[model samples]
Target: MSVKKALISVSDKTGLIPFARRLVAAGVQIISTGGTASLLKAEGVPVIGISEVTGFPEILDGRVKTLHPNIHSGLLAVRDSEAHVQQLKDLGIETIDLVVVNLYPFKETIAKPDVTYEDAIENIDIGGPTMLRSAAKNHAFVSVVVDAADYEKVAEEIEANGDTTLETRRKLAAKVFRHTAAYDALISRYLSEQVGELLPESYTVTYEKAQDLRYGENPHQRAAFYREPLSDQLSIGNASQLQGKELSYNNINDADAALAIVREFAEPAVVAIKHSNPCGVGIGADIRSAYQKAYEADPVSIFGGIVAANRPIDRDTALAMKEIFLEIIIAPDFTEEALAVLAEKKNLRLLRISALNEPAKKVDNLFRVAPVAGGALIQDFDYKQLEENEIQVVTDRKPSEEEMAQLKFAWKVVKHVKSNAILLAKDNMTIGVGAGQMNRVGAAKIAIEQAGALASGAVMASDAFFPMGDTVEAAAKAGITAIIQPGGSIRDQESIDACNRAGIAMIFTGTRHFKH
Candidate 1:
């Protein structure tokens, strides 16, 4: 039983070559299916095709090759049971010591726009899952490997100890179950979109372990990131920091806001975000021009803020950004010279990502999670994207053409900010933002105070309905001429009355954008 029999099949052939060679040198009987069998044979490893072992020709495009008793019974048998051993001997089945399999590319197959229904159906791997589950259920006797990245690790373990530990086998079994579950989740979520019915509530998702950070939002807490299998989305979860230190939970949260906001502009743009709100944003001719305008929009608030840009970073743009002490900088690409310049500030995080790679659009009303005492809370994320027709103006004066631009910009900026947020905008740039305040009025006061003389001609945007007339009064006193907010509070009439009395025009969007 020196280096007994093992099965290998994978869609991701990352480290399989060297690993298969090592197992061959150890005298393992290599059995594989379809492309994997051909690949191992090409590498000079002695390999047998599953068709040979199963005595069944690969029919229907090689889908029915590995579903026989000879393959699965070996993996599923209990090694220590006399009956299991006698049954295997009676059936002429060799014991399989290992099963390495990664599922078919169902998710990747559907990612193409023109994939046919038959194509998707063909990728639904039946034999692969059967093999994975059979090995996982008999973990005490067989080791299972789902990730190609695990091949080298398992090889190393066997080389060092002559066998994989029971603990390692159990851990690998856990990974196999997770892999099958995630594969099933993709199939279910995809089919749900096809027929438009009540998607069967049975679904699952898998996230690969990314890393354990020093802390979560605070230094005393513990945190780790699990990256989703869908790597095409434009989330901070997909971002790779190319330089500097690891990101804190707060860094990821704020950087996500910055990236989302910068992606909105049709032209080149820059957005500086703090506390999940855009402290400043601008659309201009070049990166430097946009960065300058955004910086001037709210210099005080931009301190230590995360910056996102829509264009490739150049030497001039990086040089201008170097003048500011920022927490993070993100762009699609950074020139070699620019990276060298940015490398000077070793603590600042630099992230590079393609804009086209983000999700097609935000899936509205997705699940939102919040931790609570002794339990956790989950609900739908905010689904309020305002349209011009949904806006109801209550005052006699329609907003001036100039004021309308600022109002729209502020409204968009406030949506990404933490709840109880207030944003003031002028000339399409945020002049001040008050975020994470305990109450609406407190947030309004902070924004106005930050604006100071700048508030005289600014427009204000709020995340939700103001609970009282005091917040409106505060905005008016600070010289805000126009305001946008969700009008669903109990005292909405009073707030509207206060705005009308102050000669400030107000619009009700009937939408709430609460980030927290």
Candidate 2:
């Protein structure tokens, strides 16, 4: 089929002029609308205004330009059907053989800091999506393009064979649907949030591909990373990789866990993560001391783990880190001397996230999504923390000021641990962590065993309420002084009685942090 007429309308005009010249050189008449037409004419390219093709002036601020039957019939007419061709001839409409279009900057507009609702509404391109859908629906007869990156491929094909191949048109048609679906989804999400409807009856979300990882959790599984558009949180997605090898699936997961824990601290802190669980966490006067405390927390587990720090790394800290086989070291910044010292280990990944220093902000619209067999579980991100007034001492003896501080520190770290979790902390450092066990007592026993002699005088934290008093008994036996847990279980009195019997101080925060 020979190329006859092509419509070109796009917001992103990256390669527009050259591609349009290629189309014009092929003897194809070009029809354009609004700014596209003006730009083409000024660039010495022959162009026909959209009104000339439709014989109707654009109305409603250019919203009613392409909805007319003249444009739709031109795109929808079947070239090989005698009846379709006859219908177009009866209406005196020329067939549109090609369509080049991209939607408005809706995503970019809403991403602005001070974008108004009116501005966002006005930027939603009604005609562009309509024409693209119409063209894509009839892709068997009309070639459709929605991405500027595809201009060269379409231009070369038209220059060679006068039309895109059937396979190319089919692929472009599929891409058009995806593009429009994502655009509409973004608009739907923004409007829903404006009206205070976060999770509507029908939920839709979109993410752009970041990279394809080497493998997933295991070497046999495939994996890739997708990031939300305009993510403002202090996250792994926003971190800059200063050095080292590309991140694998496990590397990204562990790094994210380490980052999340490190963000919980405002002071200088360090968190070491292994297999998506924090093995050690420490708060200190500086980055170097924090790292030392964290390493001493669990020296065995710190090997080959991902380390995240809330402060910049210096030469002394980097020197101490070089002695171990760490997979990744993430910090706010790295001094020149520190970077040079750490560069000796070529395979170590170093990520710098400046947002670590920024104060934490509340994000109401963010959600945590986990996939199941055939669906997903969605919930708001866990940003809940207990205020000082919210803590209730259920035991006969109240926790000392120092023990209360340690309890608060343990509570923060415990929330990030897996289900059935137990943590032992003292002196602003986690001495032992027992996570992902089957029962509360079992978790406490593991934690107590890890802490050994250190368990004496240390505090314990549980992610959820104990179903029985065995966990408190175990904590008392381990010489733990105070404990913190959400107290809502039916057998909560049993645990309280056990704490009173052992003179252990226990506080209820009335909240559960079950991470699964």
Best-matching candidate per TM-score: 2
Off by over 4 Å in 1: 13-17, 41-44, 156-162, 197-200, 210-212, 231-233, 237-242, 282-289, 314-316, 334-340, 356-385
lDDT of each: 0.82, 0.92
Question: What does candidate 2's lDDT look like per residue over 437-457, in tens digits?
Answer: 998888898899999999999
lDDT, model 2, position 163: 89
* Candidate 1 lDDT over residue span 1-516, tens digit each: 234788998887888888888887776788998899888888888998887788888887777878889888888888889999999999888898988888888988987879998899889999999999999998887888998777777888777766788898899999888888888877876677677533245434456777777788889888887666665547677776889889888888788778777766657789998787788887678878888889998887788999998888899999999998999999888999999999999999999886722323456324455668975666654435568899889776778888887787778768878888998888666777888899999999988988889999789999989898999899889999999998988889898898889888888888888877
lDDT of 1: 0.82
The residue pairs in collision within model 2 are none
- In order, what is each prediction's RMSD in angstroms? 3.3, 1.3
